[model samples]
Target chain A: MIRRLLLQHQRLWLLTIAVLGALFGLLLLLGALQLYFDFRSVLTGRSDLSQAQYIVVNKEVSTMNTFLGQKGFSTTEIAELKAVKGIRDVGALTGCRFDVNVTMGGGAIEGVPGMYSDFFFEAAPEAFLDVQSDRWRWQEGDSVVPLIVPKDFLRLYNFVYAPSQGLPQVTEEMLMLVPFNIVIKSKNGNVLYKGRLAGFSERINSILAPKNFVDWSNENYGPAVTAANEVKFLPSRIILQCDDASSPELAEFMSEKGYQTNSENLKNSRLSSLLRVIMNVCVGIGGLIIVLALLIFLLYTQLLISRSSYELQTLIRIGYNPKMLTARYMRYYGLIYLGILIVVVAVLWIGKSLFAGFMDEKGFPVPDGVSMPVVLLGVGFMVLFLVVNFFTVWLGLRKLAMPR
Target chain B: MQLNFRNVLPIPLADTPLPPGSLWKSDTSFESQARCLVQAPSGTGKTTIISLLYGLRADYEGQLLFDNQDTRMFSVDQWTEIRKQKLAIVFQDLRLFPQLTALENIQLKNELTKTLNEGRIREMAEQLGIAHKLEAPCGKLSLGQQQRIAIIRALAQPFELILLDEPFSHLDEANIRKAAELIMQSCTANGAGLLLTSLGGNTHFDFTQHLTI
Candidate 1:
C-alpha cells in the first residue's frame, strides 16, 4: 500500500536521478582524464627519461681535469654503482685508445676541418644505447663504420662553432650525406675506414661508433696516443640504464656514490611525481563528490518519506511494522540505484572507448579493457549508494513512527 | 490484556480553552470479551487516549500498564507485536491511504495475518453499506462511506483490543448501528475487547462498563 501510494512524487524521483547521474558523469570524466594522461606520459616516454628507460651518469669533471677532459669511472667503481637498487643494468663508456681525425679522401675540406683535427670516439653496450638500428654494428671486412652523433654536438656547431669559423653550417641530412675516411695512427699501424652518421643520441653526449671499429682502432693504433691525453686504458664515462627513472631512491644512491647525471634526468623525475600528485588529487575530489551526492540523495529520500508520514503512521497503527513498510521502500530506492549504475556504467564504457581510440591514434598501447581500478571504482560507487540509501529509508521510516 | 491507568491525565494545555475531561482520571481493567465506551465531549483528546493505548504516544503524565507491563519500557519490537496481535484502531481522521481502493485499504491490515478472507470481508462490507464502494479510491469516497471502510479495516486484523475514536462522526445513526454490529461480531469472535470514544450518543451497544474521562 505504501509503495503504490508514494508514486505521486514523480518529479522528486526524476530530480534524484538527474542529480545523481550528472555527478556520476563528472566522476567518470575525472577518472578517464587521470587514466589517459598517465597512460600517455608512460607510453610516449614523457614521464621517464624521454621513453628510453635509461639515464646517463658520469663523474663530474673537477677543475684539475677541466682543461683535459672528464675523468672515467674505474671498473671497481662501475661494479659498486651496479649494486645500487633500481639500477637494472650499467654499461661503461669506451674511449678511443688513440686520437683520431676524420677527413674526406685523406685531406681537410675547403671549409670543414678534417685531417689532424682530433675528435673523441666512444662505444657503449648496444642494448643500453638510444639508437636501436642495426647500422651501429660492424664486421671485420666491412670498411664502412656507422656513427651516432649527439644532438648537442650539432647544436653547438650551429650556434657557436660554424659562425666563428665563417664556414657554412650543415643540416643533419647534409652531414649524413658525406662518406668520410677516419684515420687512426699509432706506433703499431695506421687504419683508414669509411664512416657515416647513423642517427643522433639525446641521452648520450658524444659521437658513437661501432664497437668493432673502436676495437680495431685501439688494437692497431693504440700506442700512438701520448701520455699527455690519458694514461689509463679504462673508459672515461659510465652509463646506467635504469627501469624506473622517476625513483628518488636512485637519485639518493647516485648522490651517495658521488655520481653525476644530466639535468634532464632529474627534470623527468620531478615531472613524473607532479603527474602522480595531480592524479591523486583528481581521484580524491571525485571521491568527495560521490560522498556529497550520497548525502543529497539521502536528504531527498527523507523529504519524500516525511511527506508520507501520515500514511506511514496509519499503516503502523493498523499493525504494520515500520520496518516492514520501509522494506518495501528498499525495493523502491534500490531500483533507483540500479538505474544510476546502468547510466554510469554506460557512460564510462563510452568514455573509455573514446580514450582508447585516441591512444591508438597517438601510437600508444591500446588497453585490453578499461583499467581495473576505474571499473572497481564504478562498482564501489554503486555499492556505497545502495547501502546508504537502504539505511536512510530505514531511519526515515522509524522517525515517522516516533511520536511528535 | 489488563490495562491499568494510574492518574493518567494528559498534560494541561497552555492557554487554550480546556475541555471538560482535560484533567482525566481513570483506573480500568477489562477482559478481551467485553465492550467499553470512553465518553468525552469534543476537543477532549479522545484521540490522544486511543493513541496512548495503541503505544503511539508517550507524552502524557503517569503510567499506562498493559498486562502488568509498563508501556513506557516496551521496545519498538514489543510495540509492533502488541499492535499486530493485541491492539488495533480506527482513528478519528479515518487515516486511509488515499491512493488505495477501499478494499485495498482494508486488506493492508489483513495481509499481516490473513485473518479475514476476501469473501468474508465483502460480506461485512455489505452489512456496513460499503460493499458497492469497495472498488473506489478511499480519497474519492464520501467521508461517511470512508468511515465504514475504516471500521471494517480495523476489524480485519487479529487483536485483543480495538479502539475506535469518533469512528461514527460522519455516519447516520442507522448506518452507525449497521457498522457497530459488524465490529461487535468481529471483536467477539476474535475474543478482543472493544473501546469506542464519542462526543454524544451515536452508538447504542450494550456496554460492559462505561468510563467518563
Candidate 2:
C-alpha cells in the first residue's frame, strides 16, 4: 500500500523532503564536530597552557628584580626544567630600553623604549605561539620590515585608534626612526658607536630583530654603551621545548626549581566554562525545536489517521484483528519516514559546498569525516518519527474501533 | 409461528417490525416463560422478540430462561460474547466489510471465531451464485451479491442460535428461494437452531409452524 501511495505521488518533486533531511544532517554534523573538537582539546591538553605566566625580573635594570632574584629560574636550570613532564617550555631572550624617535618623512617622532633590541630567534612555546600564528611569518626575500604590534601599544604610544576595515600592510622603513638616535650613552657615561635602525617590531613592549643584528651590536658597542647606560643585562625569560610539557606537573616542577610557576589551568577552566555556557545555550535551543518538530509530526499523523474512520470501521467489521490493523498502518507511515530520511541525506551531500563557505566565514574548523553522524541522526529521527506517528495513529484507530 | 410452550401470550401485530426488548413478570412466577414463533410487521416487534431470545437486550418486566436457567445467569458482555460465539446475526444492511474481498471477509469471520469450515463456506457461496465474486472487494459487488456474501460469512460460523434480520430483502425470487434453502440446509447440517425474520408472502417452503401478528 505504501509503495502504491508513493507510486501515485511520484510526480511530486522529492527536493523538499531532501532539503529537510539535509538540514537535519547538517545539524548532526555540527554536533559531531563539537564532540570531535572537544576530544581533540582534551587529548592535546590545550587547557593546561592558557593561564597566567610568571617571569623573573632582572636585578640590574629592575628594582623589582631584587625580589625576583630570590625566586628566579637560572638560564641553564630553566632549560633543564623544559624537559620535565608537563613543562611546556620557557622563553629566554634579551631586551634594551631606548627612547624611539620615528623619522618618517625625515622628521623625528618619539616613543619611550622605542628602539629596544629583541631576539627574534626566541621560541614562544604556547602563549606567544598563539599570538604569533596570526601575525606574519619571516621569509628570506622579505626584509625584516612589517611590524605586528600588541593591542596595548596603541594606548601606550597614543597611536590612532582607527578600526582597520581591511588588512594593513607592514613595511621595513618604519623601524628606522623608533629611538631618537641622538647619542648612545651607557650607564658608565661612555659613548658607543652610532647605530642605524634596522626595523621596528610590531610592538614596543618587545622588539623582534634577527640574532645577527643583536650579535653585531653586542660585539661592536660593548662596555662604553653598557657603562653610559645603567641598563640591566639579563637573559629574558628562558624558553624550552619538552617531550610532553602541556601537563599540570610542569607547574609543580617549576615551583620546585626556585621559580614562580603560573599554571595555565586557571585560564583553561575559564575557557571551558565559557565553552560550556555557549554549548548549553545552543543545545537547549536545538533540543526544544526538535521536540516541537516531533510533536507536530505526531499530531499531523494522528489527524491523517483519524480522517480515515470509515476505513477503520470497515476493517473491524470484516474481522481483521486489532493487532493486524495496527501493523498495517504502522508499515504505511514507516515507509513515509524512510523516504523522508533518504531525501534528507541526499540534500545534505549536495549542499556541502554551500556550508563549506559558511563555516569558513564563521571560523569553524571543518573535519574530514562528517557524513556518518549526519546519516545516523537522520535515520534515528526517522525511526523516532515513525514510532510516534504509529502510536498516534493506533490511538485514533482504537477509539474508532471501540464498540459503541 | 406457534405458541406451543406454556406461559405464552399472542399479540396480533399489524405489519410492524419488532425491535429488540423485554417481557414482563410478577414476583412469584414468570408470565411469558416459553418458546414461541412470533410474526410482526417490520416496525412492530419482530426484532425486539428475537433480540430478547438471543440475549442481545436484557431489560425486561418478565423473566427469561435458557434451558430453564434464569436470564440473569448472563451479563451484557457475556451476551455480546454469545452473539460473537454462539449466536450469529444477519443484519438487514448486511454489514459487509468494504475494504475486504468477499473471501477474506468470510475467512476472517471463521478465523476470529475459530470455526474454520472452508468447504462449507465455498459450497454456500457457489449455491448463492456468488462463487465468482469471492475474490472481489465487497463494495464493488451488486446488492444481491453482497447479500449472499453476508449470508455466507455469517453461516460459516457455528452458532447455536442464528438471528437473521431481513436476510432475503435484496434477493430476487430465485435467490430468495435459494438463500432460504441454504440457510435451512446449513442450519440443519450444523444441528443449529435458526430464527429468521422475513416478509410473510415471500417464503415458499413449509415451516414447522407460522405466526402472523
Score each candidate by Cα lDDT: 0.74, 0.51
The residue pairs in collision within model 1 are: A72-A236
Per-residue lDDT of model 1, residues A133-239, tens digit only = 75667877888888999998888888899899887888987877777878776665677778888888887887888776787777777764566654366576778
Write model 2 residue lDDT over A1-404, tens digit each, in one string. 32232123222234334335434643544453444344334534432334423332221235665565422345566557656654455565543333222223233343222243422322222333323322244333333333333335444433333234332333334433343322333344533223334433331234343333343434444443454343344454554443333334553455454443233433344444555566666566655555666765665555555555555554454444445667776776676667766655565554554554566577653443334654676677767777776778667766654433
Q: Identify the leading candidate in terms of DockQ.
A: 1
**Backbone atom clashes (below 3 Å) for every candidate:** 1, 61
lDDT accuracy of residue A269 in candidate 2? 42
Q: Candidates' TM-scores? A: 0.64, 0.46
Cα lDDT for residue B161, candidate 1: 81
Summarize candidate 1's per-residue lDDT along B29-67 as a digit string, tens digits.
666556878887777677777878888787877788887
Kindly report the fnat of each predicted structure, to 2 decimals.
0.61, 0.11
Chain B TM-score for candidate 1: 0.91
